[model samples]
Target: MSENTQNAPRPIDIKLHQASRLLEIKFDNNTECMLSCEFLRVYSPSAEVRGHGHGQEVLQVGKEDVNISAILPVGNYAVKLVFTDGHDTGLYSWDYLYDLARNYESLWIEYLGKLSAAGHTRKNLS
Candidate 1:
């Protein structure tokens, strides 16, 4: 339980755009962000995606075609995202979402760098 979780802005609206493969979220603090489904799937905050400890992350590949199939609310704190690729474990917390939105560009760049270094490419799931 992070301190930001206690004060983080809640989502005012959440829209899923399947055609564009993005999740648009508007927060109460007037901060809005469009998170790509591929981004969310690769950055999922689950043990399966992130692993159990630092430096243990299993790099996600072939997620360029991922999309949100469903979004289920988790109490008052988070949302469970069900991805089109059959992944349904990550719980996106409000604070986490805010952080992701705020740091999206940098995080994405970093992810790309990692993928390149590992000789992996994001591909359409067929």
Candidate 2:
């Protein structure tokens, strides 16, 4: 196997707090990443937002009310998010979480811009 594939993250425990809108992900390697509901919703890996390919992503709107209903494990690499209001198709990978944690400011700004364009506001998805 390639080195890149061998070093991929494998989360051991994933906890989601609805009231706080926080997801505490603990990787097998002991690294932790804290992600917010708005952050996850905005950066969902779903085709609805990621589009079919690069540069075609449709920005999410009114995700302020989006909440994670469940976190379903996908083998050892990712987890499926069951969102409140019954929309669940996003498969969030560990790499994606890391990216979100690292680029929070940019991603947040992007989400805000999309919200403004769509005339939407994110309320606590509690």
Candidate 3:
């Protein structure tokens, strides 16, 4: 196998916890993370959220309660996340998902900062 293929992180397990609104993922490299649905929705890789270029990202709001409705496999490389809010465009690749998991803390903080800068307050889901 090529070095790139050998180094690629693959998902060993993926589970969606509906009640807690978290997506738990374990990678072949022994990395594990629980990503919140809201986080995933806001950081969606779709053009609708990420836009067509840099500095064109659209801030996502009111997604505190969003949950995964379905997890559809995309060949052998990725999964199509069907959100409860009807968003199903972003294809979450193995690498992308691993990145998200590893960077969850920093990414979530950045997202919150952006929301605050936009004058949007995130509602308490509890």
Give all candidates' CA lDDT scores.
Answer: 0.90, 0.75, 0.90
Best by TM-score: 3
Prediction 1 TM-score vs. true = 0.92
Off by over 4 Å in 1: 1-4, 123-126
Can you write out model 1's per-residue Cα lDDT over 1-126, one digit (the tens) per residue? 242666788898999999999899999999999999999999999999889998899999888988899999999888999998999997999988888898999999999999999999766454
Alpha carbon lDDT at 107, candidate 3: 92
lDDT of 2 by residue, 1-126 (tens): 122355666677788988877888887677787787767876878888788988898877666657788988888667888888576787777777666665777878877887778887666532
Can you rank all candidates by lDDT, best first? Answer: 1, 3, 2
- Shift of residue 87 alpha carbon in model 3, Å: 0.7
The TM-scores, one per candidate, come to 0.92, 0.78, 0.94
Q: Model 1, residue 45: what's the lDDT?
A: 91
Better of 2 and 3 by lDDT: 3
